[model samples]
Target: MTERTFDSATSGPIVLGLSLPVGSVRVQVIESLITARVVLHTDDSTGPAADAVNRARSEQNGQVFGIEVPDMPNGVIVRGDRGTVVQSVGNMSFVGGTVRINGRVVSGGMGNMPTVSPIEATVCLPAGSSFGLAGTSADAEVFGYVDRMEFRSVSGDLDADGVRQLTANTTSGDINVGRVTEQITAHSVSGDIEVRLYDGSAATLNTTSGDIEMQATGAASGHVSAHSISGDVRLAGARHLSVSADSVSSRIRR
Candidate 1:
């Protein structure tokens, strides 16, 4: 178990970035500090998972704080100034169950690949802070308010409360947001999306084989567009809004 803390009193609404593969993250919104506690669950204490946990690095460049775990090597370039990180995946490829970077084989085969251990991270940050998460099979839960949140994942579920803006893309993972004030754009291939919207909130939720459920509150005067290919779409408590809902081979209820 490793814990790292950063003081964000002077940074003022910092941006936190995380890249974790096969893990779970729980974020709590607090007052003024940012703390990240990580634990790697593995049987082998001297293996790659342990090494990756031991060698985890936290870098802060101005208002941007990034945590890097070597176990899942995603090409991320961090720039100094105000939290600018570029993820470059053009030179990476997976062929024949092997991982390659720049045409060089990193993992030879399924047997040669490093064992994937579940990493659990508990993060505490201030309110109004923004965050970006990149994960594979990693689930995340947030307990408080955030200014903006972005997630890109494969089979990773997300549950959050009170986000001003949110953009999430996942495959086979559900997204449930409690309160959306500004805007929300969520897409899932086979996962459900449920959100509660406030006044002047805009939402665009789409799913291929999962349900879309939305509840409007307090005037609900913004635009909402929901679509599902083979799943149900339900809208409740909505008044005075432009709504476009469609479903193919499924039910659309309002």
Candidate 2:
């Protein structure tokens, strides 16, 4: 018998702060807009969550946006929205589990914007947080803008489209993005980097020993570049591509 519950509030903002005693479960972040609203498909029905939901509902620590009992446990998806901002603070025993952002930002709605509106979502998993991409689809629309994003200690894949600016700092994980306007800066002491740009965007990828992959060519006038300590570089289907190999051990080609 799976147990679950939902406790939500209109904080005028969405902020989820999870602090509990003992439990083994996964958390997902999701967003909704338009007619095809987003839902949190959880496996746990409403048993294990009754206590937590009721307690939280009775508390006054912070504001709650939306809740789902039988929500998806593996990942939270923000669907059919124009300008929706999703964020989380991973504090469970699993630490900073995984985050999958597979949606688009529209305009003229509760969650809609043009250009990738700035993403102030800070998933600070410090010692146990991770992020990644679960799937890819053309169904996702790109109406709004992601102003900027700052990722820290995320242990999963980082995926997006039409990103204005982005920062990834993973102590142990990988970062993969697409369509960032200004820069895609990913620094991992131990991880890999992969950036595929459909529209030209500047990028700076650095890692200790993980390989770097950059594939973006849609009238992208920005320079394509990568940097690593003990990792190799690969480039394909690029226009006006330039090669500036630095290390004797590292290889660079156009």
Candidate 3:
């Protein structure tokens, strides 16, 4: 278990390659720009990610090249690509077929104002990139696909045109998704949740203590379930939608 650091003129789009132990993997992304231009925090202490890191620094032509952390652990922050972050497969194979990244936090608009840039992470599995019960609860998981997704601190002004499939949980903030995969799950504790469905997308939303606003142009069989302790629920504009507002102060405007 070792560590290393680098200082480069990092900016723009970048990819993160991570390698962990034979267990689960967790990804926790944060933004607050004070540290440096870019930072790759690891969950595991596997000496130093030499080969992969050097390669990242080399091909970084200027516009903040991508990086691959050989052993990214839980709660480890991948500080770069102030844009979109993705979850994808690796060049090699995980020693274990099981991969989980639940109980994790994925966020943008960090480090600098409007931290949400154009960063995206692709998540795919190899053959049976299967898993049993990998927890995002500070465990080391690998890239095999995602079972659940959690979101935090998504500002209303952020433009999320490339967001596909997402599962989110927010606190004192706002969330908006333009596109969706097959299913999108979300819940908020103290803010409003807004989802704008693509032409033909499906989704599901749940919240407690906040409002739910959605827009769907296409025809998809989706539903929204909202419950609150002291907030209102709102929904509007969907070809097919079913919702349950459990709070007395919930509103829906779609």
* TM-score (all chains, Cα) for each model: 0.76, 0.45, 0.39
lDDT of 1 by residue, 1-254 (tens): 33334344344577888887656788888875544333334333555445556777777777788876664444432222212222333476788877676787865532343343455667777667888888766688988898899988887899998788899999999999998888899999999999966554688899999999998886667789999999999998775678999999999988
**What's model 2's lDDT at 53?**
32
**Residue 136: error of model 2 in Å?**
26
Task: Indicate the residue-level lDDT of 1 in model 3.
Answer: 21
Q: Considering summed lDDT, which 10 consecutive residues are worst modelled in model 3?
A: 128-137
> Judged by lDDT against the true structure, how good is candidate 1?
0.74
Stretches off by above 4 angstroms in model 2 are 1-147, 154-156, 160-162, 237-248
Candidate 1, superposed: residue stretches over 4 Å from native: 1-11, 32-44, 72-116
- In the range 1-254, model 2's lDDT, one tens digit per residue, is 22323343332223333322211123322333211112222233343233233333223234323221221121222222322222221221221333223332222222221112111112211111112211111111122234444555434344444456667776456666656656667787667777766344566667777777776575555665567777776665554645333323676544
In model 3, where do residues sit more than 4 Å from their true spots? 1-159, 198-202
lDDT of 3 at 97: 41
Local distance difference test scores for all models: 0.74, 0.41, 0.38
Best by lDDT: 1
